[model samples]
Target: MKNRFRLNLFRFVLLLFVCVSCSQEYDKALEDALNLAGENRPELEKVLRHYHGDTLKLEAAKFLIRNMPGHYSFADTTEVKPYYDEVDSVLTTMKGCNVWTIRDSLVKIDNKYADLSPEWVEDIQIIKADFLIQNIDSAFVQWKKGAWARHLDFEQFCEYLLPYKAEELQPLDAWRTYLREFHPDHLDELRYCDQLKNSSLQSAITLNDNLWYYMRPEITEASQVRPIYRLSTRLRMPFGICADFTNMAISVFRSQGIPVALDFTPQWAFRSLGHTWNVVLVNNGKNVPFSGATSNPGQPHKPDERMAKVFRITYAVNPDLKRLSEIEAFVPSAFRYPFFKDVTEEYMDCEDVEIEVGDSLDGRYVYLTVFDNTEWKPVDFALIKGSKVVFRKVGMNSVYLPVCYEAGGQMKAIGHPFLHTYDKEVRPFIPDTSRRVTLRLLRKYPVLRHVQGVVMRLDSGEFHASNDARFREYEMLYRVTDCSVTGREVVLPDTLGAFRYWRYYQPKNGSYCNIADIRFYERATGKQCVGKIIGTDGCWEGNPGHTKDKAFDGDLLTFFDAPVSSGAWTGMDFGKPVDIGRFVFTGRGDGNSIDIGDWYELLYWKEGGWHSAGKRKAETVYLLYEDMPRGALYWLRDLSKGKEERIFSYEDGKQVWW
Candidate 1:
């Protein structure tokens, strides 16, 4: 027994010595890699410390170094040595300053090197190192101790750090700066975000805040569109549309080591436009969806309209989709995006489907589409094999149409639309060939994508006993810009409103409509209502100096605002009420076209009770209203939420809403 014990002790000591030697070797390798970062070596060491004693991270770091583009072999010091020297020089000058100033300096260097020999430029690894160094220093101010202290594998690092650069609207490194900007002095509220430590489901609550979601008006001409950047957006902070919110939250959470992705539909299946949002991939391998500019983080963002397909953005290139560029010219621009990863399966409740196409299509690519509000939008595509093509894992509970790209880029339907049931059954929209199924789908939801301003005239300086034209009681006009090529012509109900001069208004960003002209004519006599102009009056705040007079000053440049209340009114009194039958609004040609009225309600006061004379949907540049009770007390009120009534009237006749 004594001899056996001695042998066992010797074996144990040998094993311990071997383990210690291996650990020392690992530590030396880590140190050498840190040194390669040059002036940013200390920050690299700090980051790697999170992975101390973990072989996985050590292996990942080695892999990252080996796989980094333009990494030189040991013998090629001529290429690698100068690169590191340049990086060290740049970072040495950048130490001790805030991220913004350092970034500005780096931009100048990058521009200067743009013309320099490509050989002098550093490897992407060096650029990544510099970014990390600068971001880590800035993160310290926000986190105060451990900002990105969490240990993440190489994949996590790529997901969080790799693709972040200056985007079209956001300046480079703007996200790191945001950490300090969000809660500079009092970040404790954001620091103890233990709630964010949970799965993406719980972490989303941290991202959900009071941010408004508004789509900027679509400009028909592409040149007029402006890209909104993250720095400018952050300067305003948390008060942006969906894109702004997504960028901010993405930058903040990714810096803290959370896996995040931005996904969006090219266009809503039910609406006339598209939307983008953020989603968090939790540690549990499940995706928790959320939007940056919304109040709902506990649940997936479900638009009132149906989504055709959801495309996920990823930093890594997908080999399966790399060949897609050959089939469609737009594929590379869409699928080969550095940030695009098709995770359609995660959001779409889909199933495999085999569609019959009569003969062999061979090399042709088949596409599937669903009818959007305006036209059919192609959602997914598959390559044809035999006589038929198969779409794998597509969304169910939707009507899908098979289409093919013709000689031109135009899509031609190949098969009839069939409803793919949730239970995986595909049935023709009209299963019985003899029985005609008349399915008329009318647009019930009005597009509110571009309702930017309200047009209404306030009550004429009156505190009436009837409370008819009191504060917050007048009909306010809601303005909306039409996205279609042709402007909408709304046939207003006989009693459209009490306002005589109708004016068009747009948001401060200057997104206006193209209105042609305005004409007020009597339907009975077919005569124009333009005659002796009636004087106009409206409710004004503070002083009555800029009253309803500005609305009818024959200057589209000037506008009169009503008190910021729901029931404010504007009125016009013609010398007397003639046969003032109907009014026609004209579109403006000066590009001042801001004719957007989403909803208009004409209320007439009769026998001390407010009566709805007529209400019409206004989505076009020109609006026409017919049928009127001569000399009646009528007023146009805004039904849109949280809008004050402002009116503009034009008439030789009399009696605006009184």
Candidate 2:
């Protein structure tokens, strides 16, 4: 027995040593008896409230609650409840945009501050407890919510997904109800619109062929009649040749006192980025991409200078409709235009274009639209009772634009609000049943191949993020062939600026070469504008100037001398720094043309300060450059100051003579 006792004692000593050795690792534990013994510190109980479900955190919370000490109790001498009530009263005294009211219903079970004469000391304890309770409950409620909505970050970003949902009476769930509840005009459904309407999920497809489908008859009839006030407008960039030429021709014809509705084929080409043109409906018809309604044989209209560039064709939908793309020589398998990220200016929900009033909504989005050319007539809208015009928005949800209506031609729907209403139950659009069926089928069978996984590709396997279906819900013709996920995978050199490439040109032989990873692209601009330098050096063999200095023959890197502008601004100001830093010469020679000889002149206007920062004359500067020819390539170092002002050009005469 004595020997066994001695052995037990030895085992106890061994266990004690092992525990002492392990105490350092245990000290790092969040909160527990072991942690407290190791660190000799109080616990942060509130921190563990966020981790309520986890056993580790629960243990930490217990440690904190036990260790943290409280202040004096107030039950004997003074009433803590009355003070709490008084604080709640103060909260009700104020109200406004920047003001908030505090709730008056917290129960102080312990009269901790009753006898405390100085109210401030008692108030601190009460406030701290209140803060703790509020934070605990708030986290609990948020965590209970489902995974998608519970995520605060996603909730904050959700608005960007359904940007156009504020005023629209119906959201995704209420779309059918809204359509049935409200009156119906017509939804924009060309080839894919029908498919989209019946689809369980909201989505769309870009239909280039739809541009020529239903607008030919009307064009023939309208051409024979004398046209209205001939309207001239610019067809913006990224627009396809088919859309531009066909839509413009039809618009001119349709505006000749004939029936028409306006729609545009949306384009998001790698070459252009975001371009769209005319799509319309004529004579109470549905959405048309092209050729609709017949008035009579119209004279062949001249193409807009912009439309003159599209490849002409001879694919006519009707017997008499002879116009651009009527010959069908060129077939577009997939068209090129701008993408969503390419649009420079973003639009919003509100507009008062007809009244010359300019009020805008906070909701901003990039939309591609085609408007029918017609007189903006004033409608007798008895429904518009309120002084303020109310507008709503929808994407995948159905919305309608009107066609021909009411006696004696006095129509007014020039880009008016398009709305959708569903039955309290279900109402069918009989004429569009085929489209409806297709739309219903679409939701079940999503374009599986188009369910593209957005990835960050590198030398190794990629990490992918699902494309936000809600953000891009509209039926769009997306170019998925060259879709890339390689922006952040591999570290690329500065040569290509912002592109991904694998093969490049050999320095000596000018032959093509390859690397496992590279960054290179042919063009950078949204419009495929190949860069070009305007001015040239006296040597003329190569580029002789930088965008920075006056005396550079493509040798020195400095700064621009001054900001140059078209001299068009408010107050008739010339050389005002509104246009600052690097000068990018733009126009026909703006996209693809770039030259190395083009240089800039730097100047020092400040009289007193003498520093190296001041612009120096006759200093030759050369900067690293990679850009196309005939286009502009400039980066303004400073946008708002004159200290970095400079002129960009190649001719040496300006530096020597000026």
Against the true structure, whose lDDT is highest?
1
State the lDDT at 254 in candidate 1.
Answer: 54
Q: What ranges in model 1 sit over 4 Å off?
A: 1-55, 58-245, 282-286, 291-296, 299-302, 326-332, 345-354, 369-378, 392-402, 405-445, 449-524, 531-536, 539-658
Over 499-618, each residue of candidate 1 has an lDDT whose tens digit, in order, gives 334333322222221223333445468565443322223434444544444444433334444444333333333434433444434222222232344455655334423467566664
Going through the candidates in the order shown, the clash numbers are 43, 105
**RMSD value for candidate 2:** 35.1
lDDT of 2 by residue, 409-458 (tens): 33323222221222211111112212211100001011112222211111
Instruction: Mark the 10 consecutive residues where model 1 has the least summed lDDT.
Output: 456-465
**Candidate 2: worst 10 consecutive residues by lDDT?**
437-446
Q: Which stretches of candidate 2 lie over 4 Å from their true place?
A: 1-243, 251-284, 291-389, 396-484, 489-658
* Model 1: lDDT to the true structure: 0.47
> Clashes in candidate 2: how many?
105
Q: List the RMSD of every prediction in angstroms.
A: 15.9, 35.1
Who wins the TM-score comparison?
Answer: 1
